[model samples]
Target chain A: MPTRIFGDIPGIPEGSEFESRVMLSHYGVHRPLQAGISGSQLEGADSIVLSGGYEDDEDLGDEIIYTGHGGRSLDTGQQVTDQQLARQNLALALNCQRGLPVRVIRGYNHRSPFSPTEGYRYDGLYRIDSYWRERGRSGFYVWRFRLVKLVTVGAPNQVDEERQTYGETRRVDVTIQRIVRNTEIALHVKELYEYQCQVCRTLVFTSAGPYAEAAHIQPLGRPHNGPDTLTNLLCLCPNHHVMFDFGGFGIANDMGLIGLDGQLHQKANHRIDRQFLAYHREHFLMNP
Target chain B: MPTRIFGDIPGIPEGSEFESRVMLSHYGVHRPLQAGISGSQLEGADSIVLSGGYEDDEDLGDEIIYTGHGGRSLDTGQQVTDQQLARQNLALALNCQRGLPVRVIRGYNHRSPFSPTEGYRYDGLYRIDSYWRERGRSGFYVWRFRLVKLVTVGAPNQVDEERQTYGETRRVDVTIQRIVRNTEIALHVKELYEYQCQVCRTLVFTSAGPYAEAAHIQPLGRPHNGPDTLTNLLCLCPNHHVMFDFGGFGIANDMGLIGLDGQLHQKANHRIDRQFLAYHREHFLMNP
Candidate 1:
């Protein structure tokens, strides 16, 4: 079933037209209403589609890479001495003492170049996990919000009798499960490499930050039986990870990266374990 | 640069609303336009967005798995006696001698469940390379079109000077080239497996037919030096191919399929080359 969100703006159909909610700056106790501002705090709303702190053309992410407030206001684009209320909202969102029920609506942004037809889609519920002041790409101090999606709490897996009677159980109730990875080790390896691909030394910049994935050299789990450790991890960009996983390349016994293209890739770091590399070679590389 | 499309629908704002172009189907001389039908030859159009013949809810592919022209027309839901113009258009699309200017758009169906914002996106210019009559998911005769995107003719290593002057070249002119795969070998392997995953013996049914992908056991290219031959190929479903690529499992020396889940998978057939398997084991699989 699809997720649901509720809130309507006058003069526009709910799921069309607008890609963002009314600016959060327009909310609070004494905001104007005629200009589409909510005069008072509209708490307990199901969802709010935030546009984020990207300048005129910036992308948003699961974790908001917020620009700091108080230097120059985005609305006015003028220098300011006092802290901005937008910054305060970030702090308020982070406050666990008064758990604010701010449900963020997720969807494709129209401001981006390749905007999709999915207007303002409601991804899921989320909460502010962390926030901090940081320097943005614009060289301005911005407040960042690290938001995490709230997973749905479901009842125990009890097959519905009606569904079973129609043979829907085989079709609809099929479940595919995967192992819960050790995010700590993964994150550590990525941080160690500073979000650059180990094989190609490439870093991809996203709306959130430089994005990189941790590849388990020897995959962790039952048949592979590889350990989830920092030594067994390689920080790589998404493309290289896919190539590595697909047997597009491998590492020699001397730690030399062997790719199909014949290009010799130097290892940027030496923390990789030879034992784990050997294990990967024996099974995945296909030549022993 | 982004691909462009043309046409206007009544209420939908141009370039915003609606998922398809109204021209391709409407332009054929004597073609019926009233109920979204064309009576005769549709020519002189640059592009088309065709939503195929799936009952109520079905997905279409670049290779159109078109149900044959008669019996229960999609337009009326009643039995069709003569050739469907929609089917005829597909045939015309496949005619290279005619070479009608037809570019197929690729995107999600607005009517299908979980459709994304990118509905009917203009992917690229394409020409119908092949066509055949096939049995569809609804047990109807369907016409299928195999379309291939036309590559642009460009001079080697020449960067646009205007883009280069502003550093826009770095941002926009970056092109990542991939090795042109040997489709003949890949297709042969897929056909050998009868479009079923060799590891699981599972066939994924699409509106067109069963779909499978070919994997290179020992990757071909400079680093891995695996060949593009039957000895190095494995037919697999998309999911299992990803698993195999990621070193999630391997074929033991004795032809045993070893996976992380420890599931005992038997090889449906036995054409695997022990030499290629040994190479894959040494380099790609990690350990013995």
Candidate 2:
């Protein structure tokens, strides 16, 4: 069956876009009213009545009205019923405590409560859960209604814009720090070795980030050149650095690298030795 | 004591730069010349000799002069010396080929060769392995040489202008094919689905090559509309692709992915599901 109902609610300011599809639930102090024909009887009904009225207003001014799902009413400043006020309170509480915005709406209507065991039935008043907000020049506004009984104490707010902003800023700061550190190390090593490894002739662009790693050729604890000095350092990849540290290889005085096993280790076969040599030859401290 | 001798040898044409020191053994033709210094008391003393004679009749008529270390002269037309020539002939006959271009000028000039008993030694002469033709007003040349005899080959040549032009042409052909294939699929699906795997978005760039794998959402055997569409395709790392193929996890219709077992059967505690979800949310794929 087709149902007609006021799409836009009154009293609540408009301009809030609908964020997500509304969820239907039972009515309570904190729960918004749900309205939908039972699945089995939906084909039988020809038309449905949607009711809207101010529970606080005893006069007949509070009355049910029928309009298409997407239709809007002329009344704009009608007072919000007690049910609508309850939903607004729930949304406010959720927003204040938690950081997620509520995405439910209360339409202008009331209907008989549905029971799971019942096959199919409808009361005179039709309860509607679907609602829309007014779209302004800039943004849209959302409207919600809650029954007072469903409202709980100290419920977390769904949205905290300020806290979210701070968290985003923190994440950005951390990323920037990582990039800066990586760049600084890469550049310093490349500059120290003049863009090539002393042991190997590996060349890199800009000598910073991803391409090189700053390494202490001699152990830092030894009484020798400063750790940061270009002479005491060599730019190498992780594998080469590990091999060099274990004394598995050494650079000869003549600038050629000597592997532990006395064999010619070409770059194709011995990656660690080749990478270290490339870095040393391309970017290393040369005697003045 | 440092002894110096100077003179010019014929046939070495002028304008060719020569190193001050050379290894006598590098001379493919003149092995006996080096023998003169070995076992001789003068081995410990630095000696220099000069070879001077030039046939003014030839275009390359400059006398090649050598100083530092002991030296000997040979006729330009003569094929080295008898002893070295014999060894060269034997090697050529055994290998069934002509000998390479080798030259000898001086001996015992720099560091002493280690492992005197071993036939192999660090000869100072650098060998030219290969060459390629280039383009333009003056074609560029690439030479690979090493400081030590063992280090025979240096770094590979970079992609020069000629190679780059060829590469661009090849790239254009491949790109056109890719564009045609992509156009056949919905453009939005390609944009919506990330090029990386929905799981462990591992993007590893290594010296060997770049790695990435494209995958299909629905198995190829399945029948459906847009089954092989771009929206159903994903580019994933190798590890993640294997996991998906084995049905370790699946993405729900609501875009939420669910995992079967706690972890992959053979793989360790690599929570593939969580990894995929994390990247999906962090990279805004879920919202996108």
Candidate 3:
């Protein structure tokens, strides 16, 4: 009855009840129930739940939100109502209209320490975009949904049905030419840093207002053809444009800031060209 | 007659005449006409042609390739004929039905060397999925078409009409949970590396045949909780999985082959747990 086992196990000969699974098998799916503390609760679980909590996943930045689930009560902290079963899988992830597939079960959230050590994982495919019925951070009565993430984007000669159902063999279609930047020179260098963040000055408001990120410093397509000028841009703010595209830091030539810590202040009036800060310290900080 | 200019441009005392443009101003565009050495003719000009030549540049790619311009017959070596605006932009890029957008102008053929430094710089939209006529390499007959990159996919409460006409603001909406594997343990470790590439053994084939890439060597999410077993996988081939996930190399604790140079060679039948290659040489080669 060898149900499924593979590779090196030299010592399992002693007990032999045939229990070598390792991971990925959560069998029949469907688990959602928790409550309290939701939006962005990483270590304590919930993972994500926006909108119905009245928006605040960084104010729904990056769009799509309207997410909610469960009416937890675990005995007297009562508020569990709206017809459960994870609200019928949020009405079957909102009528599966070409999207529905998610996972992350973990011992049904006991205020989450993710102890699922085994039994639920897949985590992809989502698409419900909208649902309603809220009011329950214990005050009981929840059920929001808006989902998103079904991400299928393939048609360039199509062939990515989940990487061909995960058998994913070398695909290669290649043809990436590039050269873009002329939205009036990226909105005149993000209004000359007025949108903020010339190095953690952090601004980011939003609702259609302040929000930075222009960054470029020696990066404008294939093998650094860097030249979109304003001395190769950089207003930043998406966490310092992913920490200056992950070189973690750089900027000196007396303009100071060599690997983070500060003092490259000019605040604005345009004058950055120290040969593009020595080409971002010779291609991303002395070659990262 | 002020024509689109933005922000700070002080000073010009030494240049009494005035000329500070910096880029972008190709007015009333529509200039595609050339010939000669076409395909693969990189640095001699022709920037791109793959068949019928005409005139249409609808701000480059994302859904539009009904392109066709003029043919060049530069002093003798001739074949330029198929007229009528390249047969009505190849019957509107083979009948719109849901496609179009392209760009690659460079001194209109005549043996390439990409010199479209300006007067054309959007280049990023294509979709002609298929077209035919063949006979070229100059003996002229050309009409090919095949182009692909159209990519659109949005719809979860929409908003990505080409990144809102390219004004792309950091849109996040993420919910990407992972952990999918177990297609019978990735097909028994690609039949125990029989699919090839234990460090450049290569084996790629295609048309639905041989193709490797199992990789893993301790890497299963969250600070590498790694454990999908089969001695922690590795079949490789996407250029050695980007050189073994960019630490450029690993696998020595006497199983040999540390920073690249071959031989852990077992060929099959299991047994490779040198403590998961010493946890890929202590978490990605001595902490990278």
Candidate 4:
């Protein structure tokens, strides 16, 4: 399991920028990809991103006065009610009272020179100077916390741009290659069937074209590793794909779909391998 | 929809080999990857692959006396009853009566000098020389069809090995790359929560490691194009991933997982983006 990160994340110095919050989450420097703050009341707040989300936020590079969560209307960003001293709001206050350090990140939206031009920038550690309840923005009581940067002895370190992009690109791009192959194979199968379900022999007619899914009789991932071959594949409508995958049915050796009364309508070139059908019957089929 | 090839595939010549049935299916040479014959009773048999599947089948380089489908025990590949003139058997008969040329592919399983060492080899087109109902060695009557090679007035053509591999590799390998990314991200999310369900807050313990699925709020491919970012991802057990994907529920902007009471039990850095939650609520959430 990944350990919870607190205060400064080692190796990642101040002013390190990430293209997306998911990248931030992957690195473990800032855990919450969406939330403004990354800490709790019990442990005291350890990290906060000043994304200029709250109207009351003030960013001055070295010093930041950030607004706490809540009180905003869901539809409109305006504060609908007075802020409460609970959840992330109280968590930030705990940091101020305990004199604990908090990691700070600034988003491009955060209207400050230190903020990233596009994504989110991780500014170094900061000490919460003070906290106070103020009534100004949107005519509602808002909790504000002042934070001062805990300056390091050396100059600000900029992470290598090439290294960060390379790592993130490899991780994210490599994921879609398999999806591409699956799509091609599936599309081919669907075209062969004219987007018709094999078992029911019904076409999912649409404006663009027809739609269908390629289901693996023995499955494709771990514990199964079913071959991505035509013999192991079945083109079906979405309903059947879901049902088959959920173990609602299985395919018999003679192309009969278990749980369904009739056999799958045949396509001359799209024959199912007996081995895969047997595999599904043994490992995946559920009682009708 | 792909038009069924009746006689010869344009580019793929005689003697071209395919490593697997899937590849053969991808190319229009033979449609039934598992079935011996690629035709219907109405359309006549267009192709036949000599895979040495029948005990009484005889293969002479220029001619093949092939056994018809059916009347064999599924558990044991033995003739258990009299083979009838139906399905592919009738289809081959139509080819003989019509004098229609049928494509012939030889598999490594076929005991003949002309068969491929491995995979399936397209030998060339053949004419049905004669067909007869004969009593087999097992004392069961079987429909046997004799095929004579319809020789092309040219040297046999072999498909370029490199070209075939390159095409097939690109098509199949590209599929799992996205799967790899999804796995990595899902694994990271599971580790973040120590393999616990965020919605139900229960740990799924296993011997090797805890299993959890990472679900996307807006989905990743096609019409939605949801980002594979952390904000759009949720770590849930299998039940939830299936239910959520099947549109069982959605997450509100405030992190409340709809259809279930209360908010999602969140980890410090594992916050879901409000945009994705809202997207799910609008698009995927089904009435509960």
Among these predicted structures, which one has the highest lDDT? 4
Better of 3 and 4 by lDDT: 4
Summing lDDT over every window of 10 consecutive residues in candidate 1 chain B, give the lowest-scoring window.
B171-180
* Chain B TM-score (each prediction, in order): 0.43, 0.24, 0.29, 0.52
Interface C-alpha RMSD after superposing true interface residues, each candidate, one decimal: 20.8, 28.6, 19.1, 26.2
lDDT digits (tens) for residues B64-106 of candidate 4 = 7788898989999888998777788878875664456688888
True-structure lDDT of candidate 4: 0.64
Q: What range of 10 consecutive residues in model 4 chain B has the weakest lDDT sum?
A: B158-167
User: Considering summed lDDT, which 10 consecutive residues are worst modelled in model 2 chain A?
Assistant: A145-154
- In TM-score terms, candidate 3 sits at 0.28
Off by over 4 Å in 1: A1-288, B1-148, B155-181, B261-270
Give the per-residue lDDT of model 2 (tens digit) for B1-288. 222111112233212333322432232222234332111221111111122211110110111111111111454432222121122212211111100112223222322222123222222221111111111122211111111111112122111111112112223223222323433342233223333334544343211122344444443320111233544555554444543432334554444555532321212222233333333222211111
Compared with the true structure, what per-residue lDDT tens digits does model 2 show for residues A125-184? 112211212222222222221111111112121111121121122232232233233334
- True-structure lDDT of candidate 1: 0.42
Every model: Cα RMSD to truth = 21.8, 32.2, 25.8, 24.0
